[model samples]
Target: MAGNRAWILKSRPEGLPDMSNFELRDIGAEPLEDGWIRVENKWLSVDPYMRGRMNDVKSYVPPFALGEPMQGGAVGKVVESRSPHFEVGETVFHMLGWRESAAGPASAFNKLPQMPVEDHQWLGNLGLTGATAYFGLLRVAEAKEGDIVFVSAAAGAVGSAVVQIAKAKGMTVIGSAGGADKCAWVRELGADAAIDYKDGPVVKSLLAAAPKGIDVYFDNVGGDHLDAAFAAARQNARFAICGMIENYNAGPPPAFRYIMRVIAARIMMKGFIYTDYMAEMGDFYRDMGGWVASGAVTGRETIHEGIETAPDAFLGLFKGENMGKMLVRL
Candidate 1:
């Protein structure tokens, strides 16, 4: 039998996490249960949202249990199955991540939908990241044709998608990223303008990009980005609150000085998770698939090799080390 290895949560984080908080353990492979499948994990996703799950705070999802295997998004192929819904050699997406192999109930896994893309795309543009951009921009923000749309983390996975989707929908898109290289990539992704927040004051750069103010804001990195959007929002503008990566490791929520603008501008803001729109997956695939096929939307990724490098891949997220989706290829 093949040996198995998993990354265990050794301790809760204090501000920022470190290698000491995680433990890589070798364990005996347990037999598959009657209604479960055993999968050889091929790809593991390390997203910004996973940071919240490490804290012992109450949120939409439960925190990671101490001394247990960590979980995120993973793609794998079933090697053995005791469930009718799955078969040997079938590729799947599951939440049992940070491990080389996994055995879980059939309900915990979903077969990857057929797409003219690579398998790892399931953890990037075709997965949660894409969904976050699609629904947040189109539904939550109510962005429409000719609307001025602004997205933060514009070269990252969800932000890049937002840049493209808004442009494809006829909206003038302005994206904010860290450096000149990322900003240039955002423009290449079809954003009308790309703001390099590292250059000067974020608000000043954003105002320069959209002089008339913006109608929709797709927020990925909160904090200064949120304040910038608030400062540059036009009347009746809508904001979709996605991942707040900036504040993930902070002690408390950022005190935005421009929050008062919400009342004066009547800026509509709503926080959301990708799971909130699961029923619309079919609609998402139809539109996103078409866009992908026509080169209207592109999924980019930053991948690290081996399951052992999963921790580094995850830590790189906060450091802005990833270009698009950050994944570990096992």
Candidate 2:
């Protein structure tokens, strides 16, 4: 039997997530139980949404339990299998915990087709992050041709996707990132303009970038970003309220003042979770997969080379240290 390491959540975090909240342990492999398989983890995602999971309060996704293995999206290769649906040598994606290995029923994981060694991995641009951008922008924001699309956190995983998708739809895109490097990267992703939110007044900058006024705002970072989006919206503009990475660290949820703009601009603001539209997965895949294959759209990954460094990679998202999808390679 082999022993594998796992990182578990020991306590709920206060403000920013610290290394003290996690503890490492070793689990020895045992005989497979019925309907279950053992997987060797290959890649794991470190996303901003994971911050919300540490709290005890209920959210769109359930909170992580103390003393339990901290769970998130992971891709792994099956080393052993007892389930008929999976077999040895197959790779799968699941809500497996942060671990070198996992054993779970076939129903717990979605099997992925094996790809060439150089092919795009399923953890980033080709996976959920891409799907979130495709549906959240096209479906929720209802982007139209010639629309001025503004996206916050434009250098991050989902934000990057929003920029490319908007450009492909024949809409002018403007993005906001934390620093100059990210601003340049957002422009490389096809945004007509990129604003450094850290430079000055965010709303004022966005307004200047899109003097015609923004028709669609695909918001990933909330708080001040949302307020700014509201202020820059055109009459009858649509705002898609996605993840709020900005306030994820704060102890209490942040408040925003936007009633006046909501009424005056007649802005349509709506929040969406990916699961709510699982029925649309087929459409999303058809469009995104084609775009990815043809090089019409692309994704970038900021990979942390090993499992031990996963915590730092996860913490970096809050600090804007990553320029694309953050992944930990095992």
Candidate 3:
């Protein structure tokens, strides 16, 4: 039997994770059990959420066990199938990521539909990334037409989607990115204004971008961004607190000097996970799928080739190295 090479967590990371915490090991491939399917992974998703999983603390999702193959989202082609539902050569999406291949029961995978977009996109724009933006902005934030919306980490996978989706809904969108190039990309995605956060204090820039005050804030990078949103939000404003990438590496949480604004402004703030809105996934797919197919809601990806580069791809998220979605093409 051929050996399957997989990335395993050697130890839990204290702050920023490095190569020393991971080890690639070769394990002998075993015969498929009943109702199992063997899949050759073609693409792997490296997301910010996976950073939380590397820690030992309890979270919405269980921490990645030491010595086990780390997992995320992956799209693969089934080469062998013992189940009637899955067939040889069929493509499917599953959570068995961070490896070159996986063998699991057919129930663990969802078959991909025939679409004009590439199969890898099923892990990105047309998939969880897009869904996160859709539900976070529309459902959680309750954004409406003519509302002023601010999105932190605006050029990232989920933030970029929020920028475009808010635009599609006729909202005035303000985006914040770390550099000039990412800021430009956010503007190109139809943001009314894109703030280069590296240039100055985000609160000042957000105030300048939306002097009238923001109605909805889609927060991807929390900390300073959350403080700025609180200061710039209008009365009865809504905040959808998504991932807080700024504090992912383990550091002092950002002190909010303007927290009083949350009360004075009567702001509604809610932290949400995408899975919380799983019941509305069908609506998300229908709407986001149409917008993607029509080119109204666009998405970009930073592809890192080879499974060996997966760790680098994930680490790059902290450096703001990716403009949009980051994926490893296996």
Candidate 1 lDDT tens digits, 1-330:
468999999999988899999999986588788999999999999988889999998999999999999999999999999999999999999999999998989999999887878888888778888888999999899899999999999999999999989989999999999998898899889988988888998999999889999999998888899999999999999999998888888866678889999999999999998899999999988998889889899878898999889999999999999998898999
Candidate with better TM-score, 1 vs 2: 1
Which window of ten consecutive residues has the lowest lDDT sum in model 2? 112-121
Native-vs-model 1 lDDT? 0.91
Q: Residue 125: error of model 3 in Å?
A: 1.1
Where does candidate 3 have its weakest 10-residue lDDT segment? 22-31
Which of the predicted structures, 2 or 3, would earn the higher lDDT when compared with the native? 3
lDDT of 3: 0.92
Tens digits of per-residue lDDT for model 3 on 125-159? Answer: 78888889999999999999999999999999999
TM-score of 1: 0.98
Model 3 per-residue lDDT at 308:
91
What is residue 216's positional error in candidate 2, in angstroms? 0.9
lDDT of 3 at 210: 96
On a 0 to 100 scale, what is the lDDT of residue 251 in model 1?
A: 65
Model 1 residue 275 CA deviation in Å: 0.7
